[model samples]
Target: MRDSSSSSSKPVLTIGLCFLVALLEGLDLQATGIAAPHMAKAFALTPAMLGWVFSAGLLGLLPGAFIGGWLADRLGRKNILIVAVLLFGGFSLGTALADSYATLLVARLMTGLGLGAALPILIALASEAAPEQLRSTAVSITYCGVPLGGAIASIIGMAPLGEDWRVVFYVGGIAPIVIALVLVVWLKESQAFRAQTGEKIAGQGMLAQLFGPGHASRTLLLWVACFFTLTVLYMLLNWLPSLLIGQGFSRPQAGMVQILFNLGGAAGSFLTGRMMDKGHARRAVFIAYIGMLAALAGLGLSTSFAFMLVAGFVAGYCAIGGQLVLYALAPTLYSTQVRATGVGASVAIGRLGSMAGPLAAGQILAAGTGVGGLLLAASPGLVVAAVAARALLARRNRQPQ
Candidate 1:
């Protein structure tokens, strides 16, 4: 009975810890956008420079995901996750203290490294902690913290902090360190990882692990799906408010939309995961991508505040929710041996898309592309993502499950 009780609590403890870290990550991820105007004013940054500022953290994520995953597979998930939390938390503080553009970029880049590293580990831990039948639900529950955290950041940004953008970073940074301590006391290493034999745990080289035997096709497909999906998601996350303001919406109205978007994302993340777990993987994919495309069109064409709010919520629902679906799918594709490595690589590739999205949006808008044109251009990518994700699910279904 004691063993049963402890076993039952493992998933709860694991998912709870992962969720806290994810929450802090979400806060930091959106912090820049919330504080962008103040950051721009304080440092006298141009639009181009602000784009780089957004990309800097994403740039860190690319390598961080790869290296963090590689190491997690060999070392252990909980240890690496704790280190990642500390790294990001410390750098978040650095972000608050940065006095120059160069310093700000460096701080954000370091913060990205920690954030990037923490994500794959979180996914792996949550997926491993839950029963196989409930894997998607577990991961989605952990992932919901991200959008919810972003909503919190939006609220902080709206507060009368007197435009002291540093406060946002300070909050984002300090909370993770506290969580890290809690994790140190409570988090457990993945039982699956512990159960693996030494030889299997030390599996083939990185290239072989990813491209080994039947993995190449799925790996490529997952990358394609993640890349395009994140491109749309991050573009909206970093640029949505500015886009709304460009279209004549007030700042407060834009902020409200942002909050609703994240709230919708939290709901979508949970629902989509539950849907996939209920043997509706294909249906979930269809709904997520189709909803994304339609939401984009709505955001582009809607003229009223009410309509735009609905559009933002739908966009968040589909885009951020779609991302959770991809994440949940990633772990099932690889064995416990290389799970983190494979997931990390997929995440790293997706980070490239994330980095590109914000920069591309900036350039496109600078080139006189209106909000509608910019949103419309994303349609093709979502279509590609939809096709790749569906194909991957079809392939998974063909396996001897």
Candidate 2:
């Protein structure tokens, strides 16, 4: 009794709600970075301490990705998604209330747990809600919200509305609470998720499917590619403004550059995601990796302010856009039976890279590895990701589709 023609149309409403959630995630993700200079002065934080705070937030993400997906499978996606939003909203409030370094750090960790859980679910929902032909485009449509949110954060951080860094956290916390209430009324469980019955059929376990015959190599290469690419992306995201500040720019000026970075991410997400819809996911990703490698090198080498902004934008386009491609590619690697696990595992592994990126960058900065030196060091990671993407393309071509 379903309208087949209706189903063929994209689920605009559903994707819009998911995009809203991602937009909030993007906002919260950059909140700490925007507030870093203020927080550093208030708490007397060294570069190493700031790095720990950044890494602490990401640390929760690794486990949350896996745990959230597992819970979504059993409790239903809507249920888990609602709770994740609530947790983030509540902790973002906590972040605003914190007066001490320790309190702020703890608040970030809690906020991140909610953030980590929400993203994979949103990505999965946006993707599965749409028809097959538009899959990657659907993913990108939802993912675009991230940079859009970051751009908003940049604007807010620089706006004369308030100099208090806590204002950003207040906005982050409150907006999601309102959004979660909206989701409670508006968001539905994914159709694909509902259609799946929790029957124990004869097959390998979820993790086994990832490494099983015909899948092990593809999964492994994707993991390596995801891990390295994320490392580079997070480094830029968590520290770009800080790096600019270190290079002697005012906070507002640095924030402007960061805004450019994310705007590029938004543009790239649309362009590359559309290309993937044409069955160019692998090629688009490989090219993005190469582009990011060049951009990272430029970021380190260029001293001109204009060139720095351009470099940040290009880097954001390539690396952040490339990450979204990985998100899109992950679920397709398995059948519906194994899709959640495959995507969850990939997210979990990628988040581990996220945690490591800020921490390592912190140590590097603390040790006097100048911004140029750090960026140069990071370029090789994109090379590895590019190679892995190319290998995955070849391997998939060889497989019997």
Candidate 3:
């Protein structure tokens, strides 16, 4: 009974709401990273222990992705999204209050569970709400919250905010509470989803579909893409400031460069997501990955600060934009029956990279591989991602487009 035009426009409003939610989600995702140094000092943590605090959330994410996807399929995306917001918001507050490292780590991991579920549900709902013609744009805009949140956290957390790094967590946690309330009131359930999976045919759900024959390979491929992308991306974000400082920049200069790195990601998300709508999600991703490689190489090889900034900008742009646009591609490749599962699997797999990237980078640093060598080591993932992207695109294009 809904008018077609109205239906199309409604999705935009939903996208906007979800976009804000996505922003909060992104902030929560990186909130720990931004506050890590201060938190470490407060807890008297060792470097290795501090590293665990940073990655603790990711541990929660692995199960979170699977459960979130499954829950979305069973209970509906709206229900799970609302719950995720509440979950993340509460954890953010809890994280802020923790006086001990153990408590803080638990809070982060709990927050990660909310984040894991939140992402796939948001991407799925946004993509499903949009008319097929506008699908990529919708997904990308929602996803844009990732970098936008990252940038905001990086910028805001830099403030002195008195002694406690916990203030960052408090702020990060509370923002989502307001957003979740808004979503509960304003956001609409995805009609496309209702139509696609209406009244449940008895047999289909998350598990059955993921393990089904037609879906397993595509699901695995997306996972590989996420794993490598996250591994490299997190390593870059976590280490870039030190790397820059070691390259002869002052502390403030290194910090400024890190901000630029995140800003570039925001720009790339906007560009790559919109471009994906024009068709060739794979090809666009391929180009982004190639750019990521080139950017990292330039950043590593160049001596000038100006050049390093440009390289960092490009690397941040392509690395994040290319990697995340693949999430948008998820809904397209699978029917609603398997959408959440497929997306969840991909994200859950990628969480492995999130855990591994920093750990691996730390090892390389310990072994005395300089920043240049580290950057160089990370370049191959992009290359592999580029090839994977092309194959995925060619496969997708061959379908009845």
What is the Å distance of residue 71 in model 2 from its true position?
1.5
**Regions more than 4 Å wrong, model 3:** 1-8, 196-208, 211-213, 246-248, 301-303, 399-401
- How well is each residue in 1-401 modelled by candidate 3, as lDDT tens digits? 56988766787888998899888877777777677666767889765676677678877878888789877876788889999888988999999999898998899899888988898888888888888887878887887788778777777766764466677778788888888888888888877567766555344555455545655566666677788888888777666655666678765565566667778887887778778877656657766888888888887778888887888788878888887677877778777866776787788888888877776776777678888888888878767766666666666666531
- Best by the TM-score measure: 1
Candidate 3: Cα lDDT at 202:
47
> 209 in model 2: Cα distance from truth in Å?
2.0
Writing each residue's lDDT as its tens digit, candidate 2 over 1-401 gives 25876564438878999999999999989888888877788789999999988988888788778788777766677889899999999999999899888998899898989988888788778777888888888889899999989988888878643448888889999999999999989887788877885753343576677787889999998888888888988888889988988888777778888999999998888788899889887778766988898888878877788988898899889988899878877767776655665676778888888888888999998999799888888877788888887788788778853
Q: What is the lDDT of residue 145 in candidate 2?
A: 96
Please state every model's RMSD to the true fold in angstroms.
1.4, 2.1, 2.5
TM-score of each: 0.97, 0.95, 0.91
Query: Residue-wise lDDT of candidate 1 within 289-368, one digit each (tens)?
Result: 99999999999999989998998899889998899889999999888888999999999999999999888888888788
Question: Cα lDDT for residue 78, model 1?
Answer: 87
**Residue 37 in candidate 3 has what lDDT?**
61
Higher-ranked by lDDT: 1 or 2: 1
Runs in model 1 with CA error above 4 Å?
A: 200-206
Displacement of residue 37 (Cα, Å) in model 2 is 0.4
